[model samples]
Target: MRMPLLCIVSAVLCLSAASGFAQGESPPAPAPSAAEAQSAKQPVFNQEQLDQMLAPIALYPDALLAQVLMAATYPGEVAEAVTWSKANPKAQGDDAVKQVAKQPWDPSVQALVAFPQVLVVLGQDPVWVQRLGDAFLAQPDDVMGAVQRLRQQAKAAGNLQSNQYQNVTVQAAPASTASSAPASTIIIQPADPQVVYVPTYNPTTSYGTWAYPASPPVYYPPSPLYYAGTALMAGLAFGTGVAIVNSLWGDCDWGRNDIDIDVNRYNNINVNNRIGNNQNTWQHNAVHRDGVPYRDNRSRQQYGRQLDGASQRAAFRGDDAQRAQARDRARASMDKAGIERPATSNRQARDQVREAQANRPRATDRQPQARSNRDNPQARQTLQNRPNNSAGRARDNAFEGVRSPARTTALADRGRTSQTLAQRPNASRAAGHAISRPSAPMRRGGGGGRR
Candidate 1:
């Protein structure tokens, strides 16, 4: 049986109520053909498509990417989980997921409380996960721009409809023309990053009625306005979003902690036999997933590397075809960091991270505060697992007398900061500032912790 054209193509084109596709007055640019994505030798993406690909998680830092990736796998519970997280931030990792145990969401859905926006988008389109992951690796900064622009485009084309995307139109100053004084941009503030309310207008009034006896076209906030919205969105909402997601951040902070890349898990999903898990692979994933039907030289090179000797003239060396593909990818990545994706963590990304980390208190300075009496058997046990208070006479935790397990568990990331502090007798008493055990972030409070 033949599949429908819209089914095989973009979710945006279907315009069904479930898809939440907004129908605008103008005839859109022709949709890309199905084969253009499925059969191309390489993937190609324009700025617009890339922007769409990156919308969900572009505003997130590298730290939260892992959780978003994992959480996006189960979208239905995203809203409940986010709401619950706002109420209970201290619950972390395993504990965090337990709160929503009866919600009937996948266990994975519980992990996304801190990343509500990602959850909402995943709820809208979980398949977009592959693209969100790819974009984070290649262009961290552009993530925010991509999110705003797509909504703007979607609004312009009348496609912003979904649980996460809302529409709002308010009367504001109009765009400046030579005849009229320029107007200050109208920034439509987001109710939350998880919910984007686009500001649009009936084009007939704004641009004057045209002769075409057609439906009134809707004009989205302009591209410049969308770009401005990106900044406004981040300035206004990213902080709250990050605070919520911190309950999950203990495991998700990829750059801060050691990431044991499940080489096999990642490879299994890579499907296309690509070489090294680098920026090139990220691009390859983005291009191919979007169905551009394009596979560039880098992808070919990575696949070629899977051959016996790679480029070496050894007995197991790959054939001429593999060598050619690898060479092609190598050349492209040489000059500009854009398309010529490399086979490792991007240098620019790494440098930005390094600079950012430089200001943070060093692991040595930010030692963990472990109880010195830990070995004395009288150490305060974790009350975290205790049952509801005992009017009914409930017992204390069985794991009693154990020193702070959270301290030890949390220290594993910060260069064993807890152990370092534990070794020095009452270190904070002398330093005057208690090197508090990096606690599970509170759901809400005046905040402080090592980033």
Candidate 2:
């Protein structure tokens, strides 16, 4: 009995040890959080959309353009911020940044005070501004790369006519060189160091050389890494020979408009100042510059921190996208209180004038003329009694669109010696014509008209 008991005890201990080893070797799988799943399903920016959005700013110097894009992300704050900037025009660069640092605005907007005009243009459309912000947040690196590429492509196509911004005007180098994009270097001393001019060309028609294989022409940059079959030129040449996907394609208003902003409340604005308000459009995965999930300090998370689970994610108010939204609420409050707007700019005046003009008809419409000459009996009589001679009939029907052919057929029969006016060959007896003698031009002394 002792021998049997010892054997069972030893076997039990061995089985227990094996179970512990198995558990140690293979850990349990982790279930995915809702945030991870949501981030995974987010839409990424396709190359074409990115390229189009970045086209206008592509010409801008890197640092300023960065501020412009970031400001564009917070479009709602733009008007108020622009108004404030105008109020304090002397405060710029570091000084402007300091003034708005404590304000409850997005860091992007705070940084944008130095550039009021960029903010103004971007503020015109809240939706586009939000889209650009989402795209930038989702893929900053990709967006930057696309910007560089379009500039290079424009250069290669000789679209970059001149470049004072880069000071890279020289003899054309191979495609590898940055200066190769411009045709020639014609340097001029800029009058204002504050201003820079960058000449551009039409991307559609000017984008040189393509492969036309019985279908639409396909354009590609002179790069071997880019595969031949890729949809490289698909955006620029859809149906037409060349597509104008440059600034002309509603890409960006790439001009500087330094005007005073009239501080006023615009009541007609949605509370959620995002492109579509839902936020997850081109939001994509949140991979930071360092390729990790990191939060921005000047973000909207402060308000949203009061929530839990999916609600917290939905309450993501830490980014410029959220902080900028506060401007909308502020604007609505001002309007409801019935505050009068400040002095308007030249642009606002022109816009108001245009609106007034669009609502009313043109000044040239004062004289009430008949829409159709066919309504006048004299006009019909003139067409019907037209002489059969080519010159006389041609002069009479010059202004007519659909003239009666019955008159022509009747006139044609009058010239025929064998056939009467009713016997002329005609399509439905209306359009047929017979040759007729020309009416003699009246001499100076003649009182009667001659047939």
Candidate 3:
């Protein structure tokens, strides 16, 4: 009885495989059979021993982990079922036994049990399901031959039989004839209703109709380069593997479009504040390629505007402590204006010009004074009253260099004469004539035009 209890408990270890297990849970070992007693030497497997055995293989790849777990769980359940069958030979397998029996060591069975109820769980999880099926079909139960047939069909003819598991049958009992009938005394009829009893045998298996397990691992021609080949194929099959992993680890991407939409909308509201659209470019190119996006632009814009309004209020609360905050607000406003500016706008450049104008000085900074002018009557009369001597004129010209008084007078006279000539229509011709006038037969005295 205790042995049976132990056996049943051992079957319970298979439950860990049913649900995705934590890293710490250990798989149970196959129960030892009586035949092993004759050997006098057999390995004893406790829970710890089972844990140790399963631990090394626990970190299988995501595509293969479900299969590994199923493989680990199947042996113990099969051994328990075998033990139960041996113990109660006459008794029919009950619901529990039948249920255990129904768990055909099939990969698809394991996958179905492992995943939560979802549509895509079936379609996209071929590799994982195949891994499970491979593990199940390879189990040491007596179904190997039948599974082999199925596998052969899957391989060559691309078809599997419907009755691979329906071979076991039970015969009906014959009618009892203990009491004999009297000969014509009562014109005896054949015993009215002879009842025959037939026993029904149901064998649990995964080989029946429509029980096609998941697709098997696809094989292709091997490339000469090892790592390159591995990386290329593995990357191509990565979606399948990743999906299986997500199912196992409970981390899948969903509602991706909503996230993308939200991000774009947020950027749109702050569009003026857009600093070169790096985020948008990243979202469009890398993020979209890698994952899904959120909802539309309107929500994001509204959210950003709300944040801006709240910050502005906090900035304007007139405490000296808020001065820095106010400066930040001003800076944010300018940034916003810049961001919102028209594509062809040059408002910022104009602001720079205004700043420069504000720093320039007015003309009132200089002192004022008068220059000697012949237009003054006194200066003109003085000029007219001067002796008309060539030597006097020469003296006047000499004084023009210094002394500040007569020098002003001579300079004034020269200025007046220059103005008079400048007013003439032929001023340039008159000046040329004056310069070219042959200086008193310059051959006698000096270099004239040369000076």
> By TM-score, who's the top model here?
2
Compute each candidate's TM-score over C-alphas: 0.23, 0.33, 0.14
Q: Rank the candidates by lDDT, best first.
A: 2, 1, 3
Q: On residues 315-361, what C-alpha lDDT tens digit does candidate 3 reach at each position?
A: 47654566878767877887878853222247877776677687665
Candidate 2, 1-451: lDDT as tens digits: 2679889999998898789778885544698999988776554766667666665456444434655565554445655676787677556544566567566555446656654444444544556556676566555655655655665665577654432233333343234433413333222221233342222223444434422223321222221221223222312211111111111101111111111111111011111222332331122212211122223322233212332365566457554556658866766787899963432588887787777789786556643444345777888788799777988778878634337777767666766744554455553346555545688776897677655
* Candidate 2, residue 310: lDDT: 56
Over the full model, what C-alpha lDDT does candidate 2 score relative to the true structure? 0.46
Error of 3 at 166 (Å): 31
The parts of candidate 1 lying over 4 Å away from their true place are 1-41, 44-47, 73-95, 100-109, 115-235, 238-451
Pick the winner on lDDT between candidates 2 and 3: 2
Q: Model 2 segments beyond 4 Å from truth?
A: 1-23, 27-42, 83-104, 168-451
lDDT of 3 at 364: 52
Model 1 lDDT tens row, 1-451: 9978777675544545434434444444697788875655333444445544544333333334444644433333444565565566444333444456566553335545434334334444433554444444333334433433333443445333222222233233333322222122112323453332333233333222322334333222322322333423211222222223123321222122222233343343232332454521122223222222213444334432333455466435554677878877777777566553434458877876777698778766644434344433444454444567764433444333255677655555576776687678587677687565765766566656555
TM-score of 2: 0.33
